[model samples]
Target: MSQEGWEASSMVSLAAWLEKHKEQLIATAVQQLSDREPLRQHAAGPVRWFFDSLITAIKDNQQERLETILRHWVSMCRIPIDGEPVGLLPVLGVFKRALWARLQANPPDENPLEFAVQLDTVIGQAAEFLSKVEAAALLDEMSHRLTAQAQTSAALANSTKDHFVSVAAHELKTPLTVIEGYSNMLKMELPEATNPRAALMVQGIESGISRLRGLIEDLIDVSLIEMSLLNLELQPVWLRRLLDIAAFEAGDTVKQRKLILDVKRDTFPAQPIIGDPERLLQAIQKILANAIKYTPDGGRIAVAAREINKFIDITITDSGIGIAPENLDRIFEKFSVVGDLGLHSSGKTKFKGGGAGLGLVIAKGIVEAHGGTIWAASPGYDEEQCPGSAFHMMLPLRDVKSGEGMAPAVATAIGSLANAVLERDSVEKSPQKATSEAPAESEQKETPLPVPVVPSKNDHNKDQTKKGGTEGGEKS
Candidate 1:
C-alpha cells in the first residue's frame, strides 16, 4: 500500500475506536478530574462536556466543537478552585494524559505511533488556535478587569479601616469611661486604712483599666500609622535622656524578675538629636518592655548606643527565648505574636506570655516616622537552650524627609487621649514620685558588666561568613 493509503486507513481506525469507546473516554476524564481535591466539587459536568465535545470534533474533522469547549474551560479558569486559581493548560493536560493511557491500552491499529501523532496534532492545533483567538482578548480583559477590581477592593478596604477605627474608638471609650468613673467612686469609698483588701481590689481594677487603655492607644496608633496620620513635634532632644527614661521605666520589672538591665551609658552619645521626645520615649519603652516580656527571670538585658555615620544606633540584647529565624522581621508586623496562643500565659511581663502584639509594630512606626530603621537578629528560637536575640534601632541625628505629619485635628485628638491616660495614672502614682523612685530601684538591679556593642555592617558580614553565611536581618 502507498504511504497516503496507510495514513487514511490509520485515521479511519482512530475515528472508529474513539466512537466505539466514547462513554469510556468521557468517564476516564471525569475520574481524573474527580481525583483532584479542588476539581472534585464540580468535576462531572465540565469533564463530560469537554470529552464529548473533543470526541465529536475528532469524528467530524472540524475545530468548532473542540474550540467552544476549550474556550469554556478558559473562561472557567478565571473562577478560583478553593480560593486558588485553576489554569486551562493544567486541566487540558489531564485529559491528554488520560487519552494517551487509553490509546496505549487499546491501540486502534498495528501502527500505534501514527495514531499517537494524530492525537498530538489534534491537541496541538487546538492549543495553537486558542493562542491565536484568546491570547490577545485574555490579556486585554485581564489588564482592564483585574486592575479595576483591585482598585475597587483597595478603596473598600481603606474605607473599612477608617470606619472600623472610628467605631472601635467610640464604642470602647463609652464602657471604659463608665468603668473608670465607678471604680474611682468605689476606691474613694473604701479607704486603704479601713479596708486594705478593698483598696488592693481597686488597684487591680485600675491596673486592668490601664492595660485596656494601652491597648486602645496601640490600636489607634496602628490605624494612624497605616493612614500616615502619626503626629510628631520634631525638636532637638537628647537620646541619652530618652534611653535613661526607658531603662528607668523598666526598673520595676527588672527588680521584680531579679534581671540585670545593663544600660551602657558610656557608649551613648552626649549630643542631642532632632525628634519627638514623648513619641520616641514611647518607642524605646515598648522595645524594652518586649525584651522584658520574653526574657526569663534572672536573665540579662543590655542596652547600648553608638553613633554610626550620621545615625545613632541603639542596640538592645536580651538573654531570652530567641525569635525563630523566619519570625525576626515578622515580629514587627501588627498582631504577629510568636509562640502557641493557647499555651501563652495572660500576664504581659510573664515569660512567653500573650499580648496584642502591637508593641513592635507601633515601635517600628514611630522609629520610621523619625526617618530611621529597626530590625532584630537571633540564633533562632529555643526555649530550653536560650540562645537569645538582639534588636537594633538606627535613628538619624538630623531631620530627614519623612512623609507628611498628622493632620492638626488628628494630632489634637491623639494628644487629648494620651493626656486622659496620664491624668488618670497620676491619681495612683504621681509623676514626680515615679521618676524619683525609678533611679533608686534601677541602681539596685542594674548590673555592672561589659556590654557588647552591636557590630558594624562589615563586621556583621564577616561574622555571617564565618558562621556559614546565614542572613540575620532585613536590609535597612
Candidate 2:
C-alpha cells in the first residue's frame, strides 16, 4: 500500500480505538508521567480533543494542519510557576505511543510500524521545531529539568525517601508514647499546682504533639498509598455515616465556614455499600479538606450523600474561590497544583493555603481502591462569575457487578475482602454497622501491645542473695 494510503487506514484504526477506550489510553499515559511531575489541571476532554485533531490531521494528509495542532498544543501547555519544564517530548509522544500501542494490540492488516514510523517523523519534527518557539516560556522549566537529569540516581535511591520518612515517623512513636505517659503523670500528680505556667506549658506541648502526630500519620499514609500497602478492612457500610464523619472532621479544620448537610434525614436511604469504612472515611475527609482550603472565610460549604440508582452520590459544593474549568480534572492527580492558588497542597504562603499536594491524590487512590469513583466540577475560575465548585464521589450501594464498576483486579481485591466480611456477618450475625458505638471499656481490651517486665534492683538483690546461699550450702 502507498504511504498515504497506509496513513489513512492507520488514522481509522486509531480513531476506533480512541472512541472505544479513550479513558484507558489517557490513563496509561497519565500513569507514565505521574511520578515524574505534576499533571496539568485540565480535564481529559481537552486531551481527547487533541488526539482527535491529530487523527484528523493524519487523515487529511496535511503537514500544515499537523504543525498547527502541534504548535497550539505547545502554547496551551501550562508551565509550573517554578519553570520546571515538563517532559514536552514525552507528552507529545503520547499521541504516537497510543496509536502504536493500539495497533499492536489488534495487529492491523497493514503493518503497524508504517503508521508508527510516520507518526514518529512528524512528532519528532514538531518537538524540535516548536521547542524554539516555546523555549522562552520553558527556559526555567528546561533548566530545572536538565539539573534533575544530571542528578538522577538509582531506583532504590528514589524510594529511600519514603522509607526514611517511615523510619523517622516510627522513631517518633517511642518519644510520643513517653511524653503522653509523663504528661498524664504530671497532670494527675499536680491537680492544683501553684505555678499555673506549668499547666499552660504542658497544654502547649500537648497541642504541638497533636499536630505532629497528624502530620506523621499523613506522611505514613502517603507512603502506604504509594506502595499499595494500605489495606482496606472491608464491610457493609452506610454511605451517610461516612459522609457525616467527613463533615464532622471538616468542621474541625481551621476554617470559618458553615457546613450544610443537604440530605433530608427522613428520606435518606441506608446505602448498604460494600467498602472499607475507614478508607472511605479518609477519602471523604480529603475531599472535604480541599474544599476547606480553597473556600475563603465565611464561605458556605454544602455536603450531601444520597442514593442514586445503585450508587451513593456524595456531593460537596463550596461557595468559595471556584476552580478553573481546566483544573477540575487535575486536582485528583498527585503532586499537581492548578486553579486557585489555595489548593490542598499549597504551602504556607499567605495567599495560598499550605499543603503537601497529596490530599486529593491519596483520596483518588483510596476511592479507586475501594471500587468507587471520584471527580470534580466548576463553572469557571472567577469567584463572582463562577458559581463555586462541586466534587462528587460515586460509590456502589450493592455488590459491584462485573464489567461495570471497577477494573477486574481492583474490584476482585476489594470485593474478595467485602465478601469475607459478609460471610462472617452471616455466620456471626454481628450488629456493627456504620453508626454503631464502640464496645464498652469492660468489653474492650486495655492494651493492644504486650507489656515487657523490667527487672528491679530489689529483684536483682534477691537473685544475688539466693546465689550466695546456694554457694554456701554447696561448700557445707
Candidate 3:
C-alpha cells in the first residue's frame, strides 16, 4: 500500500467515479444506518462535500490534505448530528460496494488490483475520520443531557419547597384567625384603663399576632405567585384611594415615629385606574411599610403620585438607611436580606426593624403582572447621615393592549372619533322637546348617524388611512 504503487491516473479515475455517483452514495449511506432518522435531506450537503474533498485529497497525496477536508465536514454536520447516522462504517461500505462493482463490470486500463487498493485505502481513511467525529458527538450529547437533568432536578426541588410553604401557611392561617378573634374578645371584655397591665399585655399580643399574620400572608402570596394562581379582582381603583389605605395601614407606625407624611396626589379628583384594588393597596402598603421600618425616628417620608404620559409614578421617598450597593440588584428576590452594614460601618448608626424580606418581592410580582415595573434607588448604604431610599412603582395609566400604542396621527384620529361620539350623545341629551311625536312615514325617512371616516391607504405606508370608519363604510 505504498503511495507510489497507487498510480495518480488510477486515483483520478476513482475520484471521478465517486463524483458521478455522489447522490446515490449519500442515499445508500443513510439507508445503511440501523438507528437513525431518514436523513436523506441532511445527508446531501455532507455527502457532496465528502466526495469533493476526497477527490482533492487523492489528487494531492504529497501532503495530508484529507485531514483538513474531514475536519471541515465534521464541523458542518455536527450541529445537526442528532438525526445523522452513527454507523459510518456501513455507509463507507457503500463506496466499497460501488468500487468493486464498477471494477468487475468494466475493468480499469491501469491494473485493476492496484487501482482498487488505492481507492480502498482512501475509503478506509474516510471511515476512520467519520468514526472519530461520531465519538465526539456522543460525548457532546451526553454532556447536554447531564446539564438538562441537573436543571430539571433543581426546578423540581424548588416546586416541592413552594408546595410545602403553601400547605403550612394555609394550615396555620386557621389558628391565627382564632387567636385574632380571642384577642379582640379580650379587648372588648376588659376596659382599656381599668387594668393598665392587662391592656398593655393585650396590645403586645395584638402586635405580635399582626406581625405573624403579615409573614403568613407573604408566604401565601409567594406560593400563589410561584404556582401562577395569583389572580386579580380587576376594577377601576382610585390611585389616591389605594395610597390612602396604605397610609392608614402604616398610621400607628407613622405616629409612633413622628414621620412627616408628604402626600402629593394627582390634581384631578377621582383619578381612577383599572386594577385589583386590594392587591394593589397591599403592594403600596408593603413598600411604605418597608420605608417606615428601616427609616429612623421622625424621618420624613414623602409619598407622591404624578401623571407621566401613559404611566403614573407612585414614588415613596424616605430619609432612612438606604439599601446596600451589592444587594440592590437582587432586592426583589424572594426572602432576600442584607446584613446590617451600618453596624460594621463606624460612622453610620444601625438601621431599625427587621422583616421576612418578602414584601418587596411580592410587590414586584404584583406590579409586573399589572404590566408595570417596580424599582428602588438609593444614594448608598450608610454612606451619609441619612442615605435615603426612593421606591418607584411605575404603572400604566390605562391598559396596554396590543396596537394601542400608535403614532401621533393615529392617536389623534382616535381622539377625534371619540369626541364625535361624545358630541352625538350631547346633542341627544339636550332637552329638545317636540310638540308631537314624528309620524311613522317621517321617522322612516330619518338620516342615519354619522361615523368618523378613515382615509384610503397609500402604497408606501399602509398605516396611513383615508377618512373612513374603523369598521369601514360608516359601520355598515
lDDT per residue, candidate 3, 117-196, as tens digits?
77777767666766786678678889999999999999898878778889999999999989999999999888687978
**Per-residue CA lDDT of candidate 2, range 1-476, in tens?**
12333356566654454556556666655554444433433435456667677667655666577667766777775433233546456566665576567656755456667755655665666667667646755786689888787677555665787688778877887898798788878767655467577777777777777766666676777777788887765434445555545555455454334434343333335424556556666677777777766666556667776778877777878876788777887876655776444343433212247765778888877877776788998887775553678888887665632323333554564456556656756744556543477678896553322111112223312333223211111110
lDDT for 389 in candidate 2 is 88
Clashes of each: 0, 5, 10
Which structure among the candidates has the greatest lDDT? 1
Local distance difference test scores for all models? 0.72, 0.60, 0.67
Q: Report lDDT (Cα) of residue 323, candidate 1.
A: 92
lDDT comparing candidate 3 with the true structure: 0.67
Give a tens-digit lDDT track for model 1, residues 341-448.
Answer: 998889888877679999999999999998999999999998888899999999877631121243344344435544655665685476676566445665557332
For candidate 3, the per-residue lDDT at 189 reads 86
Which pairs of residues collide in model 2?
Answer: 83-141, 85-141, 345-357, 346-355, 347-354
Candidate 1: where is the Cα deviation over 4 Å? 1-162, 399-476
lDDT value for candidate 1? 0.72
TM-scores for the candidates: 0.56, 0.48, 0.58
